[model samples]
Target: MNSKFRALTFILFMAFLRPALSQSVENAWVRRPLPGMKLTGAYMVIKNDTNKDISLLEIQGPDAEYYEIHTHENIDGVMKMRQLKKLKIPAMDKVMLKPKSFHIMLIQIKKGRLTKQAKKTELTLIFDNKVKLTTETKLSKGPL
Candidate 1:
């Protein structure tokens, strides 16, 4: 193909791919489970830059048997955790997944999947409207 034709093709391809990258996951971090423990927690920032709301339908971690979204609430001066069916991120906004707020629970994790040392763990973030994104979480013994 001619040089001009190739340049045009590249521009068209990039334009087709722009919308897919508008959403992003940032500051992804997962707590390393203690020895003999079967669970851990994960946190991240989910950004929705589109004009419509996005709902986080599910999360899948290879190191864990399952995952669930959770949130903590103050009830009568006591903190309680409840599992959330789904987490929503409004358009042009971001959802911060952290301790004492919206977070992910990695349940029944396989032994030795993560250690005390720092490691990179992959998790699949499933969203509504047929969106799925995978992000790597740095694993460590975090205080939160």
Candidate 2:
């Protein structure tokens, strides 16, 4: 191959490969809210496809006043939720957020808006590398 052609090919390959090797978010979903309750939970899968670990800085959305990254801790047989400053996803590993585990807590829902039925909501996840991932989740009524 010509030198110039080879150089151009390398550049193009890097451009496409960068995103695949970097951190990414996948399979993000939120639990349905309970009837007559303003509080709900969100879950997602964070995958660090790169060779380096990534830290999730924050989570935000329009439905709640404040979104917190939290984890359920079992203290003396009592499970309690606690705020987590940051969530770490190891390199080439996947972290699953589920009920009674690490989750995103949506607090202080805006009043006067109906949220009893299932609807699609958008959430912005901020990472330490300044990458923002916008994911859609279906909001439904939680178990009664």
Candidate 3:
């Protein structure tokens, strides 16, 4: 192949690689929950930049006693929640955790104090590869 032809082919390959290289977590935010509510849900979209499957293993927060991965399903016309062992996100895809769906269950609020006053709670999401992503979430009042 000529030098000009080879250079054009290389340029085309690099153009196709740009989108994959730019993949990242975008607009990751969770709503603040109401007071007296023992549990709250987190929702976010994860954009997979690479060509590999990612599994979300766990989520944790400092304000709660413990956190667990959960999914809401309609079984026999009744809405029920079950513990999720792991959440899987396909390559170049997005996973959304929303109300009445898959979500992170934050349980056991600290005693004797309302959640509204709490500050600087760290939400750590652990992936299957042991990659931990932390997001700071604030508590709010009202139903999610």
Candidate 4:
């Protein structure tokens, strides 16, 4: 009976602690799209500590008509960008959303917006299980 009670207590403790351990963000930023271009990409490092995998379902904007999770694939020695329905961040690990790897594509950007002059922006990440995490991203016009 004592062992059973201890197990139950452990379960309850982990449940309450899960949210605190769920997600953390690092080095989040948006790369300024080329002049007059309709698309640009954002990069970041997402760390997850929970025991379950988390799926990044969507990215909400500081300035964009829309967003998509995308990755570059090498096909026949040629690289192409493809949209992902969702990007998964593995449990107890981190995912780097970087240029030509995995990234958030900001589409149909508002003209003259998100320029380096703007300096910074906020992006709200919506994950599976309805978890939303918002982070400020620097607006940059440089490599990686």
Alpha-carbon lDDT, every model: 0.88, 0.81, 0.69, 0.88
lDDT of 4 by residue, 11-124 (tens): 999889766766878999888777778888899999988888999998898589999999998889899988899999999899999887999989899977876578899999
Candidate 3 or 2, higher lDDT:
2
Off by over 4 Å in 4: 1-20
Candidate 4 has a TM-score of 0.82
Per-candidate Cα RMSD to the true structure, in Å, reads: 5.3, 3.7, 3.5, 3.8
Model 4, position 63, has a per-residue lDDT of 86
Q: Residue-wise lDDT of candidate 2 within 82-124, one digit each (tens)?
A: 9999999998998988888899988877674326554678889
**Candidate 2, 74: how far from true, in Å?**
2.9
Clashing pairs in 3: none
**Candidate 3 C-alpha lDDT tens digits along 42-104:** 666666666788888877766568778788999899999999899888876878777778777
Give residue 19's lDDT in candidate 2 (0 to 100): 65
- Clash totals for all models, in order? 0, 3, 0, 0
Tens-place lDDT digits, model 1, residues 1-144: 699999999999999987763678998989878789998899999999988999999998788888999998888989999999999999989999987788999999876787775479888999996789999889866663
Tell me the TM-score of each prediction against the true structure: 0.82, 0.78, 0.74, 0.82
lDDT of 1 at 79: 96
Better model by lDDT, 2 or 4? Answer: 4
